[model samples]
Target: MNIKQADFVKSAVFERDYPEELEHFEFAFVGRSNVGKSSLINSITNRNKLAKTSKTPGRTQLINYFLVNKEFYFVDLPGYGFAKVPKEMKREWGQTMERYLASPRHKLVFVLLDIRRVPSGEDLDMLEWLDHYGTPFKIIFTKMDKLSNNEKFKALKAIKTKVDFHNDDVFFHSSLNNNGKDEILNYVEACLNGEVE
Candidate 1:
């Protein structure tokens, strides 16, 4: 997909506050804190600062919506787990995510995982929740540039020991090198075109 225009539309915390443009399908980006959601968004959109990137985890607190090509939205869902925030705030974040996931406007969810780390309990729980709700999702292993070719193989194998996913079922991305950017963008295009579910 050739991105002609990508702009920050709004930040929202509740369904009532979601952009009135529900006609546009929303592809939600969700994952644990510090998993590189913002960086990946910036990379895919070819915008350096479209989504804020931070070294600190949980920097993205609200649901940020970015309009891409004026056709759909790239929804940056709040990162979950290991944000160094209060327990109540974390719980509230989880609740907020649950409410958003139930919306029909949420067409697809990209569940990002750090390739260097084993999938956390929270990560597994997110997958289970999506399965239970029948939400269409794609797994993305980030930070691929941090690993060697052999290490990449081993890491993906280790992840499969827990998730039971096939090689083609997930994507490996690197914001640093822009790896897997084309495949992801193409997938998004297919999704919007009704070629992929």
Candidate 2:
């Protein structure tokens, strides 16, 4: 889809604080802290700095929503698995995410994973939780530019061994090169057109 306009709408900490008009479909992005979730969002939307990117992990503490094309939303769920935050704060973020994921308006969720490293225990747990909830999600391997061909192959193999996924369902992305941007945006367009579930 051509993104004529993409803008940050709001930051909601609870279900009641979410946008009152929920008629549009939403695609949510979730991953561990410093997993390039913000970079990927900015890339796909063709807007640099639309979603705040930071050198610090756990910077995104709220459920940030961005209205895309004035039709649907791209929801940036707070990153998980950041240990620097207080335990109580982590619990609050977890609750906020659970409520957002349970919402019916969520059309799909893109689970980002760093291609350079093995999926952490927290990542695996998130995958299992998504499965338990029967949430539809696709895996996106980020930072592909940092990996060699052999490394990429091994990483994908290791990831598949840990989580069941079809080759077609997984996408390799790089924020620096804008890799996989078109495929993601096209997939979003297809979902918008009722071409994909």
Candidate 3:
């Protein structure tokens, strides 16, 4: 769908702090700390700073909400598996994300994975958690601009070997060149329209 107006609604860590518009659907974005979740959101929404892009990995510590087209919500769940953060903080982030996922408003989740790196244990665990909970999710392989076509082919093959996923369930995205942006948005539109599962 076309995102004409994307605005930052609020940052929430708990259910009570979320926007009261329960009628609207919610799409959540989640990934490792340095996997470029913010950049992907900005690129998809065509906003430069809709979600903060930071040089530091673990900057987004709270669940951020953005209203898109004044209709639905883009929930930016905090990044996980940042090595430098305290163990307690990491655990808290995991719990916070689980709490949000448990809510009924969450329609779909876009799980971003860096193309240049192998999916970590946390990444695999997140995918398993989504599967176990029966949450609909799409895997996004981000930072496509960093790899050549041949390198990308091999990287994707390597990742597939480690993580069992269907070709239709994944998208390659690049924030710099806007690669796979349209396909991703189209998939979102399909999901919102109940055209695709």
Top of the candidates by TM-score: 1
Ranking by TM-score: 1, 3, 2
> Of the pair 1 and 3, which is ahead by TM-score?
1
Residue-level lDDT of model 3, residues 93-116, one tens digit each, is 888888998877757899999999
List the lowest-lDDT window of 10 residues for candidate 3.
18-27
lDDT tens string, model 1, 1-197? 88888999999888899987656467999999999999999999999999999999999988999999888899999999899999999988888888899886757999999999989999999999999999999999999899999998888889888898987888989999999999999999888777975
Q: How many residue pairs clash in each candidate?
A: 0, 0, 0
Models 1 onward score TM values of 0.97, 0.95, 0.95
What is the per-residue lDDT of model 2 for residues 11-94, given as tens digits with 9 covering 90 to 100?
998888887555555889999999999999999988999999998898888999999888988999999986498999999888
Best by lDDT: 1
Ranking by lDDT: 1, 3, 2
Better of 1 and 3 by lDDT: 1
* Evaluation by TM-score, superior candidate among 1 and 2: 1
Off by over 4 Å in 1: 22-24
Count backbone overlaps in model 1. 0
- Candidate 2 lands at a TM-score of 0.95
